[model samples]
Target: MTISKRTLIIYLVSLGAFILAVFYFIKTNELRRALKLSEENRDSIIYALNQRSKKMSELDSLLLTGDYNSALKGYKDQLASSDSSSFDLIQQRIELTKKFIQQSRRVVNVDSVNQDTISMDTLAENTRRPTAEEIRNYDSLSFALRKYQIQLDRLKSQLQKKSYGEYLTFSSKKGNSVHYVGQVQNGKANGHGIALLNTGSRYEGEWKDNLRHGEGKFYWPDGEYYIGEYKDDLRSGVGTYYWPNGEKFVGEWQNDQRSGQGTFYNEKGEIVAKGVWKKDELVRVEEK
Candidate 1:
């Protein structure tokens, strides 16, 4: 039996509605994911801002009351306990802390305040005068400020490089033996980071799509270390290899072997061999 024109039209409309519904569902999921990530980033930034604001208030109180020892002790404890990954969202909060600190410093550094035909220089100077404990506290605060500033600078560098992306740490399971910690993007270690292997060999540095790429340092379980450029997970390009037995090689490498020019040094820090090599074997020695 042939369907009537109206019936066929109704069936087509129903199929089209079904397709539209599926499209809307997929788009809505994507939007939800984006919103979730945005919310997380916002929360992290807000948390950092709150913590810094609290610290700023405490610093002001300490300075006003000359409670330098307590301030210094608390600052040190916080730094010691801070997690490395805690700064992953630092870029969002750096400006807030910097501005607050700058304003606080200015307020603290005022030399005098004018009041009712009297200059309050004496009182201001006395209040601002640094005691020994205050000096120590200021020193530690300065150091901590510099440290966080440096971290922000590194993050800025990473943003420029875009090699690691924003996320930190990429983990995998191929059993119970392997683990990784470092910069990750797109669910893989795509930036600078470290990986631990079951054999006790650990590699740290730049990565691309989960492979060791760019500059990296690999430490063998036997105490040997390879510091150099890597391509596709093999030591390539310029690098230095150090042996626990006091042997070292510095030079060009290709295809996981020494090639082109290189210098060999013994434990005495003296160059033992300088020359060309092929496939991990010395091909020619340079005339010293």
Candidate 2:
């Protein structure tokens, strides 16, 4: 029996409602994911800011106690420990620290202390009052102090560069392993850079708005090289790479693995290794 127009309309309306429900479910899940990521990033930023503020406050206390040396030490420690990804943010904080230090130095009133209390004049002048020509003779000391100032300026400049986009930061440990965390922008590594599992394996390459795109080289601690193309943080396209043990490969790579046609050679410059590599292993080896 044919359904009435009213009944047909009712069925169609119910189907439409079901479709809308599915759409709403997918949209809600996406929104939740976005919210979660936002919260995580917010927390990270807040934590970093709080830590810096606390350190700066400590420095202020040290200055009040007339512990300039200790205050400078604290400042250096914070500068070194700051998150590399937060170059811009940390740079602003560092500059603030510098301003505070400079202001404190100006108001230090070292003129009041005599030879009795650590010799304020000696500390301020760093020596007995020197004749004009004698002060000129202290060029070496002046040069050394200026050199330190230059280094501080350089770090400030680097942090200033971070304000533009995502960048990366890495540090080498005493054990010779590097710790990298950050992101990159345009053709540079921006944001938090990471160096994970230091087998001396490093990823120093170009990033397209934070994704690995274009050419890059992966260097192994043992002196092997993987020079090739990258897409979405994986190896892709044609590349020529050399192994640490004198083995070399020139071929196409896909998804961080060797694929398609390529050549492999041994240390003796002989065609001992030849084949298709899949997931870093040789799939087909053609003997010389």
lDDT for each residue of candidate 1 in 1-288, tens digit (9 for 90 to 100): 999999999777766665544444444444444444444444564455456546634643442243444544554554454445434333312322233233334223001212223222322211122345544544554455455445544643543233212333333333324345445677777776555565556666888887789999887666788999999878899999999889999999997899889999999889888899889888897874
Candidate 1 wrong stretches, greater than 4 Å: 1-177
> In candidate 1, which residue pairs clash?
169-182
Q: Report the C-alpha displacement of residue 71, candidate 2, in angstroms.
A: 27
Full-model lDDT, candidate 1: 0.58
Q: What overall lDDT goes with each candidate model? A: 0.58, 0.53
Worst 10 residues of 1 by lDDT: 109-118
> Residue 268, candidate 1: how far off, in angstroms?
1.0
TM for every model, in the order presented, reads 0.44, 0.35
Candidate 2: where is the Cα deviation over 4 Å? 1-200, 209-211, 275-288
TM-score of candidate 1 on Cα atoms, chains taken together:
0.44
Q: Which candidate is the best by TM-score?
A: 1
Instruction: Measure candidate 1: CA RMSD.
Output: 26.2
What does candidate 2's lDDT look like per residue over 69-105, in tens digits? 6766775676676556444544443443344344345
